[model samples]
Target: MTRGNRILLSCIYWAFVLYVFVPLLLMILMGFKDSKFIGFPIKSWTLDWYLGVFSDAEVVSTLTYSVVIAVLSTLISVVVGTWIAVLLEGRKFLGRAAIFGLTILPALVPGIISAIAFRIYARLLGIEPGMGAIIWAHAVHNVPFVALVVMARLSTLPKSQIEAARDLGADPIIAFLRITLPYLIPAVLGASIFCLLLSFDDFVRSFFLGGYEPTLPVLIFAKLRSGMSPEINAIATVALVLTAAIGIWAERFTRRTNKDAKP
Candidate 1:
């Protein structure tokens, strides 16, 4: 492409980014607004809304719940997903496609449908819908995503290295730990971050599963049902900033590690 065309493409890309971010920018601006109602173009600036967000005990608890669930779900998803990916990629067996399909089916299904199904399933299991249910639901959805990412990374790996490790008297577990796991680290981290963000940001799943202890998204939904507030904007702005930071850090870490691993 010509330089002018490239410049035009870059401008177009930035325009698309701005289109997506305009609402977030507006929310951040509204968070500082002194006005009672959330509106465009701030009348005055103040930190009272942010302070109010921090002071609200319910909000604090909801945020805490979100963080805890997200962290736990991410950890579980990463381990299980990575293991499934390794198994699928490293070995061939009968009904492999069926196993893989079942693993990823949760992600393919609509969130509402998955949530409803899990709610019913949990009820049948005598498990009260709560944090545990939400964690498991989020992990179920995240596992497929993590598996796909890690499997892609595994697909690109040098099979000979794994074979060599095994040939050199390394057991299956040792060969995997030494050879396969190192290569999967970046992908695993990337998937874990995605899982964390997904679990934290999810509303439908949390709503169906969260009977008493509300996640941040469910709390935001409840607050919205009553009325819009600048405090909501403040909370949203903080969540957006934190999620963005996590995403950027995860991307950078994955890229840096992959680059450093190049032969």
Candidate 2:
């Protein structure tokens, strides 16, 4: 903790902050531009682009579609991932290592590769490209993250709680329901928010697996093909603000839940 080192670290942190926020600020600014195109030197500004987002039925529908997909996928991933985490957390099963590796393999795969693989798998299973396909892909991709978070939380859980429940004649399911599930709530909520953002922001999988109707990201990409506009910036900025708000709320809520859950 030398003065010189502190200054260097401070500079680095500010530089990183600038790198992230500068683009976001610019994007938000561009959304207010009065022109149809995106560029520098905004001679005029208006809220029309932002207003158009809500006024346009297509945009509203696509946004709703994206939210639905994210919610469905998050639910599936949370249930499946939490179960996997609970099963493997302190177990010594014969196939535990293999199962753990397979569970997380989807997260390791590159997005394009995962998307393409899912496309093929969905076709093979006779699953049409649409909501179900997108949800399936998103849930599979999100499972590893959920499992990792839940596993970390499970690691911090006191073994005494489960043992005490069992000693009271609670069965395995009852012990888990009364003791383990409550303890895992904060982690599950955090992971659900993370997965929701991931699924909503996802483009590649949604693109390949989507049908005639587009998700928000897919709709954005389609609009990009026509060329960038202030409208697109407005759309992205709105989505960014919503996701950031959710993340901040989830962080505070999870922190509060952790405090309340503490004995």
The prediction achieving the highest lDDT against the true structure is 2
lDDT (tens digit, per residue) of candidate 1 on 132-234: 9999889888999999999999998998998999999999999989998888888888899999999999999999988788898888788889999898898
Q: State the lDDT at 199 in candidate 1.
A: 95
C-alpha RMSD of candidate 2? 1.3
- Candidate 1 lDDT at 184 equals 86
Instruction: Point to the candidate with the largest TM-score.
Output: 2
Model 2's alpha-carbon lDDT is 0.95
**Model 1 residue 142 CA deviation in Å:** 0.6
* The 10-residue segment with the lowest total lDDT in model 2: 254-263
Each prediction's whole-model lDDT (CA): 0.89, 0.95
Cα shift from native, residue 172, model 1 (Å): 1.2
